[model samples]
Target chain A: MNSFTPDRTSFEARLHKIGDERYHDKHPFHHLLHSGGCTPDQVRAWVINRYYYQSRIPMKDAAFLSRVTDPALRRSWRRRIEDHDGTEDGTGGIHRWLRLAEGVGLDPDYVSSARGVLPATRFAVDAYVRFVRDEPMLPAVASSLTELFAPKIHKDRIAGLLEHYEFANSDTISYFQHRLSEAPKDVAFGLEWVLDHAVTKADQDAAANALIFKTEVLWAQLDALYSAYVSPARIPPGAWQPGEGLLQ
Target chain B: MNSFTPDRTSFEARLHKIGDERYHDKHPFHHLLHSGGCTPDQVRAWVINRYYYQSRIPMKDAAFLSRVTDPALRRSWRRRIEDHDGTEDGTGGIHRWLRLAEGVGLDPDYVSSARGVLPATRFAVDAYVRFVRDEPMLPAVASSLTELFAPKIHKDRIAGLLEHYEFANSDTISYFQHRLSEAPKDVAFGLEWVLDHAVTKADQDAAANALIFKTEVLWAQLDALYSAYVSPARIPPGAWQPGEGLLQ
Candidate 1:
């Protein structure tokens, strides 16, 4: 309620700042993960749980796209859908995430159904869709700005995951590799859309708020992981227990 | 899956042990919370966020209740609805929770509408409701095991919050006071219902799973708080932010 406003800073800058401060790029696990500091079980848990997030991104964008009327806007956002769902079948970002899952020794089917996803992960992703459905369109678009920092973390993750984890294969990392190119394009277009529309101070604030929402969505996912796999006791029912099988 | 079937004695004991271990009873915040170790600001945040959880409990039970045709069961479950919504205006658990909110300096109007609650709190609770609505009657009843633990915590919370916090009053602690008496009765009934009905190993496992689900629901709510308020970097949009007014 601090009506303090920033004047015409491209709106994107505010969104980017939100990411600079809040994005999972700075999450502890990411460093431990990228630097090969996490346990193998931890690495698999990240890939498996994150597969739920990765699979949802396209659906989230699709939901966002379905709300827009302009063919142009719809077309621009549709790339996000393509990037995840892929052209036909076992291909898109989801497929690549599946590869990550497989490389990390998870079942693609289990990841896709999201049967074993962390509860916090499920709620956070669902929260994004609800935010779009509940709030204004501009903020909804602004929330995607987490993509603003996705490329870097995704790159760090791909390299770190590959270098640190022996079970992982490059084919399974297809999703991260694809994201290196796709996220920038998506973030650029989404940024342009948000910047073009968020004219007033409220708009900038809204954009800033949206990125905060996206950041929470990612952060909560990690909190669930840390609590469940690392510093934790219960992983909740139906969540993947790292020590559940001979695979571990 | 761990197919090692346990007897009713071992199963119930092991399940309760999980409660002792994995339950939010073990969460530091909850301990700080019920033990009155939290700041007044922290207490206000707790009540404001928690009112959302308490307010929805009855509605979720109602939703599940509607799906059940057993009149005896309906008669039993109906008590929860009455416990929350109450017999008349400003009666029941919610009104009392408003007192708790008021005790902590939050507006009653805001508390009831959940205007300042964290998005993570909302989603975690909503997921619990969805779980009940989607699951069978047994699990629905089983999810209420958190209530069994609540009465003890409620006592500690009411006494500790009133005794320790500067802002609380006897009237404000009325919510937990009532819950202290009401929860044990309700939880006892729920435990008996589940224990008697879950005759098979799968049924017992599921009942255990349901309790685990409830534990996660509560735990995830706190995780959301720890990430958002405790960590601050992950605070989502449309959630209560400190040093700012409680509106989005």
Candidate 2:
């Protein structure tokens, strides 16, 4: 009996539904952000902590590639690494991240080292990597399907950061600029990979689970940040002190 | 004795020498950049490809932590991660990175995924990670000693990009604005680490080598961008398409 079936919707719709439900819009931080309820210290803390996960996605993709057994899948998936780490000579997403690090008043070297990242952010991003690593290959690839709905979030995020945050700037966020094009391509590839491989009811269930897991991965990071930076005490260790038109 | 030993200049001077002889300043693109010789396409490629590397630095740092066994060292080193990641979750350095992406008029997700980033960029960044992981721990820390010299280069790069690259706005590059303060703190910490840890002649030599290695890692990425995007080709296979007024 096929207990769990792939509810065939436009891949976009399914992914969008995930965002609609779990994308942090309902979180207090979003409310505070859009409503301008956050403190400047909160904003600075937000900027400093998120950089860890920002820096990890590409390398984690590379680690994921190392675990995959299929050559065709490997060939296709390895590009994520190149997208982040760059080629034989350098010049890629990591470098762009350094520029972002600088924008938030971080030293690129310190930022890049991930030495001081929030425990929760590290755990969430680590969970993302571990999810991709431990899951079925189909689901592993499926996890990245988040990109299917990314352009919309990307748009909202850019406008929200620029309009609401004081320390924020569009140029400092250039890492996202290129993602508009890259996400479509990556989603298309990931979608096709999942569709081709996830033919069983079980696979479909796993695929949905992968998406949920990824959502949690992102959600948890945000939750940690909100707890640490957004509210009552701002007690997270190593948080950035705000001043001079910072994230307020 | 292996004779790549550097002379006894002030630590700052030694660091500056690394920048002078091996920094991207010597790269052809910088010359073309400062001389007003690059086409719009060349500038666009530079912006887009570099975005990949800019986004990934902190990940390498995290991975470095994953490998190291010391708790106190990790505790101290962890501060770097917080500086870059910030406390607001994605609103931190990663979010700021997204802003930079938006400034370039690229999609944040696409940029974050680094799908269209250049191959050369990947190579250089990987080299940094590899250098950290492959070398002795002190040199690995020393490799990051490059931060000491960054304030000057960052200032120069900002001035040059603003002056020579018409596509950029000061706001677009706000990531650097924050770095002016952050880099010095980090450099002080790193320099202190190296001076204290480089307890032997070989250790000092490795520190020097680390600085050289870091400088080359950055310079090579620029070189690759120059060759692929500037003048002759306009756009290379999988390189970014040049757009007007999108200087990064």
Index of the highest-DockQ prediction: 2
Name the regions of candidate 1 deviating beyond 4 angstroms.
A1-5, A243-248, B1-248
Instruction: Count clashes in each candidate, considering only residues at least 3 apart in sequence or on different chains.
Output: 2, 86
DockQ of 1: 0.01
Using Cα atoms, each model's DockQ against the true complex is 0.01, 0.02
The global C-alpha lDDT for each of the candidates, from Candidate 1 onward, is: 0.73, 0.65
Model 2 whole-model lDDT (C-alpha atoms): 0.65
Cα lDDT for residue A197, model 2? 69
Best by lDDT: 1
Candidate 2 ranges with C-alpha deviation above 4 Å: A1-248, B1-16, B34-39, B70-72, B164-167, B243-248
